[model samples]
Target: MLATIERVLILDRAEEISKMVLQSEIAEEYFRCIYKVKNNLETQRKIREFIKVKEQYEEVQRFGKYHPDYRVVMIKVRELKREMDLDEHVAKFRIAENELQSLLDEISVIIGHSVSEQIKVPTGNPFFDSSSNCGGGCGSGGSCGCSA
Candidate 1:
């Protein structure tokens, strides 16, 4: 019962901190960019067109060598993809989204590190370590089996 109450208090505090973070300048900018892109009719139309073309191309591919229009569909798909990538609004939105995602990823990593520390879990660059014998079975010439 006490543990449950403590957990609820911690969660409440965490939610409060999250609300504060969302009101910060960086979060505000992220939301602004996201809303701007979402509200753009032209951008939305282009995105829909691109998705339709991509789906058509995928369907053709799924038919394998049996589909006669596979080559033409692939060409159309590539063209549509290129045009979509060239769109200014779409490009800007992608950049903004990437930035926001990176920020979120960094925050998640920080929180993960904090939790790991409290739990006494080993945390650091999991990629390469000369001291630790827990060679991640990465099969890249190292004891870890992880492939390069």
Candidate 2:
């Protein structure tokens, strides 16, 4: 039930945060690594191959050991995965991507906690998994962050 002006202000602040993230060193490195992965033809080819093999492996997995080609398909998938992981640019890109994701997760956790620690924000990091703690107490403003 926010008024138009309040909604607009919130939207504006979101835009500002987006800009700040885009300018951060973590974000910059993420973009650089992603660009390298995107432009590398060998990586692109391997990615495509991996996707195809992975899908086939999934199909075989549904049948468990009964699938005649399960072992063969699984072996091929693992081999392709190793190749993909060995690529320098792909490895760097994955690291950068994970770092950026962690940064964004932290910001999300902060915003959620500010409103109320009772709010459950799912950051994949085990250290930030405060969904159960709820800070301290209910609403005495002990640590449950709600300021009312």
Candidate 3:
């Protein structure tokens, strides 16, 4: 266990590292893309529409198939999701966001491994985890020859 002074020093260094990260290329792109997404009128309108549909979808989910509008709400949610995913600004923002996540994950992995190679560091890739049953879409209900 670290002492209070040691913890405070680590936190101060962490803030410096965070500032360096925000100045990096991927982080800069992430900020820029998010700014566009927030300011674009059409995208904001579409997002508002999607939020309304999502709320309706959530309500339908509470009743499952028993809800009279279940099928239609599900379809609308999927379609809206697709449209949002296809938007150029949204797509770029998502890509930057993922890239930034990957960078942070890498940093975490380095820190964890530095402390102890046996420590568990989640990199969001099952293949990197020795305890995972299978890394081939098993989580999506597809059989990957692993007994569940």
Candidate 4:
């Protein structure tokens, strides 16, 4: 399985590669952490795929029993276990937790950085203004206030 390299800095054109690459450095540690995670997933997927590729690998030993990607991926896996003091296959779970938070943070930052007000008008009825509906769900046929 091919590893998906997430683009940290959104780019529009070819000229933006410099900016993307530059901003990528600001999140160097972030990207490094993400890469380790993505590579780990790829490694696990490859392990499953290896059952199919095993014959090809055997016939063509240019990459040997262990592909170069396997070593880097395995090293990251080992590093994660040692760093987190995790046992056996539990590191994958921990990495998912960390990566999920990192992903959420990155997305929040992106959204916060480029925020725009969305105008949601109630269809073509301009008279029925949402701003005027201040009674919460009461305006939508749901109870918001209690009977005294």
Best by TM-score: 2
In model 4, the runs with Cα more than 4 Å from the true position are 1-84, 116-148
All models: lDDT?
0.67, 0.86, 0.82, 0.44
Each model's Cα RMSD: 5.4, 5.3, 5.7, 17.2
> For model 1, how does the per-residue alpha-carbon lDDT over 11-66 read when each residue is reduced to its tens digit?
99889878876887667877776786678887777778889988888898889768
lDDT of 3 by residue, 100-148 (tens): 9988877777777778765666678553544334442356554764443
In candidate 2, what are the lDDT values of residues 1-148, reduced to their tens digit? 7579878998999899999999999999999998999999999999999999999999998999899998899999999999999999999999999999999989998888888866767676766774546432356654555432
Residue 103 Cα positional deviation in candidate 4, in Å, after optimal superposition: 0.8
Q: Candidate 1: lDDT over CA atoms?
A: 0.67
Question: TM-score: which is higher, 2 or 4?
Answer: 2
Q: What's the best-to-worst order under TM-score?
A: 2, 3, 1, 4
Backbone clash pairs for candidate 3 read none
Which candidate, 1 or 4, has the higher TM-score?
1
**Residues forming the 10-long window of minimal summed lDDT in candidate 3:** 128-137
Ranking by lDDT: 2, 3, 1, 4
Task: State each candidate's clash count.
Answer: 10, 0, 0, 0
Would you estimate the TM-scores of all the predictions? 0.69, 0.80, 0.78, 0.22
